[model samples]
Every structure is written in C-alpha cells, then in structure tokens.
Target: MALTPFLVLGFCWLPYYKTSLVFKLCHSVSEAQQRKMGHSNVWNSHPKNYGPGSRTCRVCGNPHGLIRKYGIMCCRQCFRSNAKEIGFIKYR
Candidate 1:
C-alpha cells in the first residue's frame, strides 16, 4: 500500500510506457487527468442529455467554454445556439 504511488510513477516514467493501465482498466478519469484529457465523442454526434442541472454537465460551469465559445459539455437544450456557431464538422 505504501509503495503503490511509487510503483505507479515508475510505470508512467518507464521508457516503454503506453497508456496508463489502471485508467484503461477502470475507465475512470481522475480530476488531474481531466485538464489534459478529453473524451472522444466520435459516435455521439448528438449527445443525448440525461437531463438539465445534472452533475454530468460539469463542463457548463467552465467560464472559458461558455463565454468564449459557448461550447460547454452541456446538453442540447443548454448549448444548442453556440453549438451551431462553433461549427462542428465530422471528419472521421
């Protein structure tokens, strides 16, 4: 238990390191990772909303995404206008 962090650090710093094994297996994004990471929305062209004011809409709280681009991680009801302005184009 005491050596867990060290072991994890070593794995991350290894020359042959690929993706983080724990993240891939657990499929959980830690708060530290969220800054540098964004989920792939390849299939979710029109992401279905679970509902408004939900915790899952955390991105809406971001002043940058909302003020500058209005590109919050919010549902269609909340983000529809700017989503059009943002001009999302599917390439792949």
Candidate 2:
C-alpha cells in the first residue's frame, strides 16, 4: 500500500502506535533510504528544550510530575521512594 502525507505525518506524531501500517512499511526500507526520504527522523527532528518533553525523570524517565527542585530531576513517585537515600528527612 502506498503511504499518504497524512499517514506519514501521523506516524511522526503518534510514534507509540508501533503496529501502524506506515511504521511497518517504513521499516521495510533500508535506513539509508529512510534518511534520504526524510520521514523516519521527523518524530525526533525537533528539540525539546523547555517543556515537559525536555524534563524527564532521572531515575525512571517518567515525564509527568517531575521534581526539578534542588536539581533532583526525578518524578514524584521515585523521589518519595528514594527521598531518605538522597538525604531528605520527613518531619511531623
């Protein structure tokens, strides 16, 4: 099946859809050919410098609820689990 522009664009945006026909077709092509076509790298072409995408948790790579305070750079869940090890003391 031939790929449409919408399919190619959608493939780039929704990369989690690994079962997509577009992804399957694209992977059939050699990496060099994919680079020449310029669609395979579209998903990662943009830099995530200043948003949730840029700030992933250091411990588990979770993007949500990231704790950037004190440069912890961990998600809230990981932080809570490892807080004592990292020198945090809970007080009542």
Candidate 3:
C-alpha cells in the first residue's frame, strides 16, 4: 500500500526525466555536426526589405490584383498590356 504512492510519482516523473535526457544528448552534439544536420540560424535567411502592409503594384498601384503576376500586384488589363515588359511570353 505504501509503494502505491511511490509508483504513481515515478510514473508521473518518468516522461519529464526522459525529456531532459534527450535534450542533454542533443546539446552534447558538436556544432559541426549540428551544421551538417542542416540546423541553420533562422535570422540569416530573413528578408532584407521586409515591411508591414500588403505589397502593391510598382506601376498601377492597385491592391486587389487578380494575382501577383510577374512579381507585381497588377489587374488583368495592366498585366496583359505589360506582359511582355514583365517577362511573360504570350502564347498567341
């Protein structure tokens, strides 16, 4: 009967102990191995010119374009007219 409480406590603590052991094992790995494992610093790949607000078209300045065609926010009319300039080769 006294062992019942101890068994309950051991079961509850088992997961926490295992988690700490796994973290310690990961931390013991060398930096070179971590790099080879593809662990990269996220900040290194961050955009240089990130900003708030939705991106707008460089030419017409419309926000609700059908799609970001040719990397610019442009409506259907503007996109068709400037498709060649924007680097999209028309089929017809």
The TM-score values for the models, in the order shown, are 0.19, 0.54, 0.32
**Candidates' C-alpha lDDT:** 0.41, 0.71, 0.52
Query: Compared with the true structure, what per-residue lDDT tens digits does model 3 show for residues 1-92?
Result: 11211111222423334555454433333445545545455545655554323555666776555456455667677888988896889677
Give the per-residue Cα lDDT of candidate 2 at 72: 92
Number of the top lDDT candidate = 2
Q: 1-92 in candidate 1: lDDT tens per residue?
A: 12222222322432224435644333333445543443443445666655442334343453232332353455454465555665766465
Alpha-carbon shift of residue 85 in model 1 (angstroms): 1.7
Q: Write out the backbone clash pairs for model 3.
A: none
| Deviation in Å, model 2, residue 46 alpha carbon | 2.6
Score candidate 2 by TM-score against the native: 0.54
Residue 48 in model 3: shift from native, Å?
A: 18
Q: Residue 50 in candidate 3 has what lDDT? A: 47
